[model samples]
Target chain A: MTSSNNTDTRLMTGNEACAEAALVAGMRFFAGYPITPSSEIAEVLARKLPSSGGVFIQMEDEIGSIAAIIGASLAGVKAMTATSGPGFSLMQENIGYAAMTEVPVVIVNVQRGGPSTGLPTLPSQSDVMQARWGTHGDHPVIAVVPSTVYETFVWTIKAFNFSEQYRVPVIVLLDEIIAHINEKITIPAHDELAIIDRTLSSQPPESYLPYKNTPSGVPLFAGFGTGYRYHVTGLCHDETGFPSSNARIVEELYLRLNRKIDQHRNDIIEYQTLDLDDAEICIVAYGSSARSAQRAVRIARQDGIKVGLFKPFVLWPFPGEELAELTRKAKTIIVPEMNLGQIAHEVSCATRKDVVSVNRVDGTLITPQEIVKRIYDVQV
Target chain B: MSFRYEIRLSGSGGQGLILAGKILAEAAAIYDNKNATQSQSYGPEARGGSSRSEVIISDEEIDYPKAVNIDFLLCFTQEACDKYCVDIKEKGILLVDSDYVTKVPEGKFTVHKVPITTIAEKQAGKSLVANIVALGIITGLTGIVSKKAVESAVLSRVPKGTEDLNTKAFNLGIDLARELK
Candidate 1:
């Protein structure tokens, strides 16, 4: 994949790649605030979207940014918004609103350090827990973390696809490192891309239900002003999309929302394992931390240590089963992240093993040497 | 084992070090068919603050993007030179702009001092092309990327109207390095 066309191999930043891939994935509307590390995505879209017959709007704030994208998605356009930690925090309510309303919107959080604007220009994977739980309620979450600029491009497309197919909000979690780093990526040809657009209702406007449950547990979408008159609310709603307080109907709605993603885990979940076959030590990581872990694994292997890496691109689905299975032969597991043991807890729970948590909350990325030191510490 | 070459372009903002890093990385990755990763870190200040762009070129996939063992280091300011010179590997090349980066620190790496900004001003007609000149010198001195690849990458990245100026600056840099050798 190259700069403009599919055949040309060009140098691009992770933000640029994400923006370009969103266009390829049929994103026609972008609404975002200019945040450091993530602003480039919005800037690129602003320059290219209008030329490509798409819409780009710089909202007043992050809250307005996400709300605008949600509104665009409801209007039958594939929409996305990019922001950093502070902005991601502001969009939490709207993210929940989209999830409850079953609106297929892509929200990208290019994570920075902090509980509250800790570091604006630096990278940190501290938002792992926030991405899964920040939106409030027990709604199922589909979040992807891309470790490379190429993966950022690839998974941004997948995020849109997952959102459209399941009628839910999908989050692409990128830290400052992956978002700003420049890499050589080839943009695949349009035909080579697999874009899953929202499934529209074939039923007449009177017969159509915006949130009707089917065998897949995914409801058909009917865009507003598309002759489909249906209620949409964030409250617990039944298949008819209207607010319903009845216990059974509300419970069923929540169950289906969870089941649609959980039952189809095999299809929605994506992960990668490296040199785990005969290894005695395993490193679990994702996003930019995965890059450091990968290098640590290589260095450890060269030092005659049996070490491997388990990287999850699909973070929300967690891929616990796969990690547990892959690390069955390993004697110890190591979970390294930018946060202080956010995903490490998940690894311990999944594998029923005590994991060596190598964490850094500082603005800088965790170095490979730092991870290698942890691997050696746990190796004994 | 595959070979990995790391390069760090360090200077204040407006030096175009980041763009030079990108062009060098693109030359290796796109044209040379090698794998490359370029990452940058800068201060909040728009200009005069410390800015550093690092590129890693490897025959294999780049597991980590940041440069740990720098093979080539280009410094446009004394602060960047002093801060980053320690990270260069033994016997690595350290290129500095003699105009701004005075008092070069003694290190294990080989030092090549040149009046980069002055040359860019005199030959390229502006100091803005110093990054391009530095790219040429880096390419010529290390031969990490082919001259043809660097030229193509530079032409593709520079603004349309300034291609001739950038080319002149790049060639001057290459010739300067050749004379140094």
Candidate 2:
């Protein structure tokens, strides 16, 4: 039965959109622990997943949450888990496991204030470094940070696609502001969305090697119960998935995992450039901070300042090349984040230009007026 | 003319101001064909805390989501009214619930003493739907969203089996707003 609530255009929170997008992207397994800001994702999935014949398990902790999704992914089902800062910290070990095992899973981190439960209800973009490096060891990650509720939905789908395509754990980073904010969104018809599923090994169970590397540096996954009795381990493993301490084998496995993402960097990086064609000053921001930057750019333009905006959705595998290319003509790049200059450092390193950082860690959003003030201050 | 209208709804947490804000935004964006965003603020406590929700309706895409200089403000409590009244733009609109907010602060903005709670409790039998009632009155007074669009949005968001009560509350609110006008 169709209802008005079921209409294409409805108001949705960013976390709700993330959950719905995951369902659309063929996610059948969700294991998450409730945490503020990110809890809505788990709450919505808990109620909705079962209706679609998917499983939603509220694990004991974030560690178990990520572990369960990894296990489910190994079994060939698209899986995900959502958490906030403290819980995200708890999931790091398992996140590392998922990365090392090349298990395809989407991890949503709705960022709240923290070193350790700094602010439960407030927003922060401090998890930028954590999402990329919190997981121990050298492992490749594709992290996407969305600025809008609509982009949250789109990027969640992209997160699933990238995870499956590259056989890597993908992180969708969201800040508290975006997570709680509700906005009108138009959900596209199912047929309109592009979905990517994991590639399965064509070789028979006897011949199949789960970790077998290919030219693309991605191995075809043969999930359990598929007659492909392949072993899965977090240790440095060879093509057969057996633990390997051999220096050469370890080197090859590490290089392959990194190369799988590095080689395909162009395809994985996604960003948007606003009015940069003739801009002299560019504002570099992402997630919720980008919203303020966009407004600042407009206000600056009105006052006849050649200000532009470069917003990156894909934070990791940091769209450095595209950002450098886009802001080539700009003399200064203003990096405003909820944190104190995490992404700003990357912007400086990538562009090799003067980067001005406007940071706020007070658990309040960086206002457009503040960005506009920076634009004027830097212009002179 | 390109314009952006910011509406702020404030009250205690359980008063459902957030839901009202969502309904108003949905009506503007979905039914009225505009760009809108709804954001809310509340204390850590779930209830009895000062809560506020803001919706920004724009002809173009909304860059900043939060309300800065509120074009319209609806306060269901005296505390919320006093706290947020200063943020309203000069000669803007400030709507206070007459039942709860008796002492209105003098401001340059237009003040409308809406008996939102009294109307909801008396006319609709359930003061729980006061938020919806406020939404209907706001729509009626501001004409920001069409009557039909607000009705559709209210029906879509209100809980099942209580649609009739909420609809009655909304209509009564519209009638009260008409009388004030």
Against the true structure, whose TM-score is highest? 1
Chain B TM, every candidate: 0.98, 0.97
The lDDT for every candidate, in the order shown, is 0.90, 0.91
lDDT of 1 at A158: 97
| Residues A39-99, model 2: lDDT tens digits | 9898998999999999999999989899899999999999999999999999899888988
Q: In angstroms, how far off is B27's CA in candidate 2?
A: 1.2
Candidate 2: TM of chain A?
Answer: 0.98
Model 1 C-alpha lDDT per residue in residues B9-126, reported as the tens digit of each score: 9989889998998888888898788999889888767788889999999999898899989999999999999999999999999999999988999988899999999999998899
True contacts kept of each: 0.71, 0.65
Give the per-residue lDDT digits (tens) of candidate 1, residues A1-380. Answer: 23533476678889998999999999999998998879999999999999999999999999999899889999999999999999999999999999898899999999988878777888989888999999889887899999998899999999999999998889999988999888887777678879999898898998887888899998888899888788889999878888999999999999998888988889998898899899898999999999999999998899999998889989998899988888888888999899999999999999987689998887878899999998888877
Residue A98 C-alpha lDDT in model 1: 93
Runs of candidate 2 exceeding 4 Å displacement: A1-7
RMSD of candidate 1 to true structure, Å: 1.6
